[model samples]
Target: MAKATTTIEKRVPTQAEQEAEALQEVMSAVAKNKDALLTFLDVLGELHESGALDMAHGALKSRHQIGVIGMNQLNKSGAQNMIKNGMNTMQFLAQLDPNKLQTMLGAVASGVDNAVQPDAERPQKKPGLFDLFKQMRDPQVTSSIGMMLNFLRGMGAAKGRE
Candidate 1:
C-alpha cells in the first residue's frame, strides 16, 4: 500500500495583521533617526502648510523608505524609546515657540484658500431647463424614474384601499 500524503496549508494574514506590520515599520523607523527624523518631520510640517505636499504625492508615497531608514538608524543607535522621547520633544518645541505654530497655521489656511479658489479664466457651466429635461430622456434615468413612480403609485393605492 502507498503511503498517503498530507498537505499543510499556510494561513494568509488578515487586514489587522497587515496594519500592525505597517505600524511596527513606522515606529521602528521613527525610533532610529532621532535627530534626522525630527528634521524630516519639521520639513513635512512646512511642506504640508505650503501645500507642496500635494504636488509631491507620488514621491512621498514611499513611506517604506522613510520607515526603513529610520529603523536602520534606530537599530544602530540602540535607542528603544527614541519614538516616545521624540514625541515629547516635538510637543515641547511646539509649546516653547507658539509663533512658529501660528505661522505654520497661517500658511496652511492660505494654502487651503488658494486650492479652493476658482481661476477667473475658467468658464463656469450653467445647465439649462432643456439640459435637465434631456437627462430625464436617458434610458437609465427614465427607468429609475419609472421605478420611483411605480413605488409612489403603489403607496397611493395602498392608502386609498385603507
Candidate 2:
C-alpha cells in the first residue's frame, strides 16, 4: 500500500502574480466598457483642448481662497436677504395647490404672449382712463382684478401675522 498523505500544503500567490491578476481584471473591465471609455476619453480631450482642465486644476489649487471669498460674500446682508427671500418664495410656492398653480402659470404665459407687441407696432397708444374703466367692466378683467385682490388679501394677512 502507498504511504498515507496526512497533510495538504497551500501555495500562496507571489506579489508579481497578484499584480498580474489585478492588471488582467482591469484590462477585462476596460475591454467590456470600451465604448464608454472611448467616449470619456474623447470628452476629456475636448475639455483639455478648451483649457477647462487647466482652469479646473487652477480652481482646485485655489479652493481655500475661493471658500473664504464665498464665505465673505455670504456673510453680507444682501446675500442673507437673498437666501431668506429664496426660502420664503420656495415655501410660498410649496403651499400653493399644484393644479391651480399650473393653470395660473399657463394662463400667465398665454397672457404675456398675447400682450407682446410686434416690433413693427412699437409705441402703440396706451389705453385712456375711460377705456381702462370700460376694460374693468369686462368679465375677464373683473376676474383678474378679483384674483389680484385675493392675492393682496392673503399677503396682508401674512404680514399682519408677522
Candidate 3:
C-alpha cells in the first residue's frame, strides 16, 4: 500500500504580516491619488478661507439633508446601539481628566443653546398645555410615562419601609 501524505495549509495571517500588508496597500493608494487628493484639499482650503463653503452648504441645505440621509441608513437597533456606545465612550473620555470633562460639558451646553436659538433672532413658539397633552396621546410616550411612574412608586414604597 502507498503511504498517503496530508498537507495542512495555514489560513491565519500573523499580526506583523497583516500590518505590513495594510501599510503597503495604503501607501500604494496614497502614491496613486497624491496629486488629485492635494488638489482637492487645496480647493477645500480656498473655499474655507473665502467663507464660500459655509454659504454653499447653507444654500444647498447640505447639513440637514446629509443628517437625514445618514439617519435613514441606520436601523432603530443600530441607532440605539450607536447612541449607547457614544454615551459610554463620552463618559469614559470625560473621566480621563477634569479639564477634558469641563471642555466637553461646555461644548454640550453650547450645542444645546445653539439648537434652542431661533434663526434670524426670531423667538420660538412655546407649545401650549393642549399641545403637550396631544403629544402624550402617543402610545410610546404614554408607555414611557407609565414605566417612569411605576419606577417612582417602587422607590417611594422602598423609602416608606425604611
Candidate 4:
C-alpha cells in the first residue's frame, strides 16, 4: 500500500474576524440582559429629565478649576495643620489595642451613667484618711490603681518616641 500523506495548516484571525467575534460576544450579552439594559436606559432617561445630566456635564467641564481651588485651600497653613493632625490621630488610633480601648470605653460609659444617676439611699459624707485606707483594701480600687500605675509606666516609656 502507498504511504498516506497528511497536511496540517494553522490560520491566524484577521482584524475583521476579531471584530466580528467581539460584536457577537457583545450581542450575546445584550440579549441575555435585555431587560436590565432597558431598565438602565429608563433610569438614565429619568436622570436626563431631572437636569442632573447637565449638572454632571458642567461639573466635568469645571473639574480643572475645582481641583486648583481645592489644592489652594489645602495649601493654607490651617488646612495643612488640620490634615497633619488628622493623620496623626489616625496613626495613634491604629497603634492602640482595640480590645483594651473598648474595655476602657465601657468602663467610662458605666462611670458616666453612674454619675448621672442619683443615689438617694447613700448619704453624702466626706471620707476621712481612714476611709481612704479602707478603700485601698477593695479589689476594684486595687485593680484601678494597678491599671493607673501601668498606664503611667507606658506613658513614661513613650517619651521621645514622637
lDDT of all predictions, in order shown?
A: 0.79, 0.90, 0.81, 0.89
Please give the distance, in angstroms, between residue 83's alpha carbon in candidate 4 and its true position after superposition: 1.4
Question: Which lDDT tens digits does candidate 3 get at residues 141-162?
Answer: 6875876697699789989999
Best by TM-score: 2
Q: Which stretches of model 2 miss by more than 4 angstroms?
A: 1-13, 96-141, 156-162
Please say which candidate is ahead in TM-score: 2 or 3: 2
Q: Which 10-residue window in model 3 sums to the lowest lDDT?
A: 114-123
Once superposed on the true structure, which residue ranges of model 3 sit more than 4 Å away at CA? Answer: 1-3, 52-162
TM-score against truth, every candidate = 0.26, 0.60, 0.29, 0.58
Q: Model 2: per-residue lDDT, tens digit, 1-162?
A: 899999999999999999999999999999999999999999999999999999999999999999999999999879989999999999988999999999889878877876884346444577889978977877977988898899899899999999
lDDT of 2 at 101: 91
What's the distance in Å from true for residue 117, model 2? 7.9
Q: Candidate 3's error at 75, in angstroms?
A: 26
Residues 1-162, candidate 4, lDDT per residue (tens digit)? 987668767899999999999999999999999999999999999989999988999989999998999999998879988998999999999999999999989977976776677368645577789988997998977987888899898898888586
Report clashes for each candidate as comma-separated counts.
Answer: 2, 0, 0, 0
